[model samples]
Target: MALAAFMLLLLPVLQGCAIQVTFDGASIPENVNTASVQLFENRAAYVNPVLSQTFTEGLKDRIINGSRLTLADGTGDVDFSGEITGYDTEPLAIQADAVSTETRLTVRINVRYENFKDPEKSWESSFSAYRDFPSEQNITAIEGELVDEIVEELTENIFNKAFADW
Candidate 1:
């Protein structure tokens, strides 16, 4: 009983020596306390009027909310700048008649992340996400909703890549 009591008391002390982990999975460097997210320009073949602003804001929001970083008007310790590289559609799920039953909408963005505190950790990469809609639905009628969903997914990917080290 004495040994059991001693082990229980030592558990808390032992835990203090373990590696720290965050609930959000982010592993932002200690020196990186500020960040900047530039407006992402839409350079895709097909441009959506509000896509640039929407995507930029979404990425900013994700970083601010997910980390302990402050937003800066200009460059901060961490900088994020990117462009929408692709917005396209393709046919999926062909039917017996050789017609597509579903249409896939894909959005791709190229991201450049700079960590001034650690330049070696910075990277430039492209991220993409897609959604499928019924072939019968006109894209014009569902474009807004589809874009919102795609933006959310893209922002998560960007955040994870930049801060979560994933």
Candidate 2:
């Protein structure tokens, strides 16, 4: 009982010495306190009128919600600029009758990341996400929903690349 009491009293001191971990799992450098996200231009041949804005805003949202960095105007300690390079749909899962049972919609973005604090840590990469839907459904009817899903996935990928070590 005496040993138990001593251990219980030591717990608070041990807690004070424990390492703190952020719940978001972001591994951003301590000096990177601000970030900027440029409007992603739609350079794809098949342009979805709202894709550019949607993707840009989606990225901003992810950064704001997933990290402790502030969103700054122009360039910050970290900056992100990119363009939608490919937005295309291709037939998939063809049936025995030679007709596609599903169609795959893909959105690809070429991203350029700049880490002003450490230029060597910066990178340029392309990220893409897709969704498959029944071929019979008109794309116009489902495009918005599909695009939302794709944008969410793309934004997550970008966030992970920029902030998560893994």
Winning candidate number (lDDT): 2
For residues 106-137, write the lDDT of model 2, one tens digit per residue. 99999999999989989999999999999999
Q: Scored by CA lDDT, what does every candidate get?
A: 0.90, 0.92
Model 1: weakest 10-residue lDDT segment is 14-23
Per-candidate RMSD, Å: 3.4, 3.9
| Candidate 2 stretches greater than 4 Å from native | 1-21
Residues 27-105 of candidate 1 have per-residue lDDT tens digits of: 8766677999999999999998899999999988888788888899789999999899999999999989999999999
Error of 1 at 115 (Å): 0.3
Poorest 10 consecutive residues of model 2 by lDDT?
14-23
Off by over 4 Å in 1: 1-21
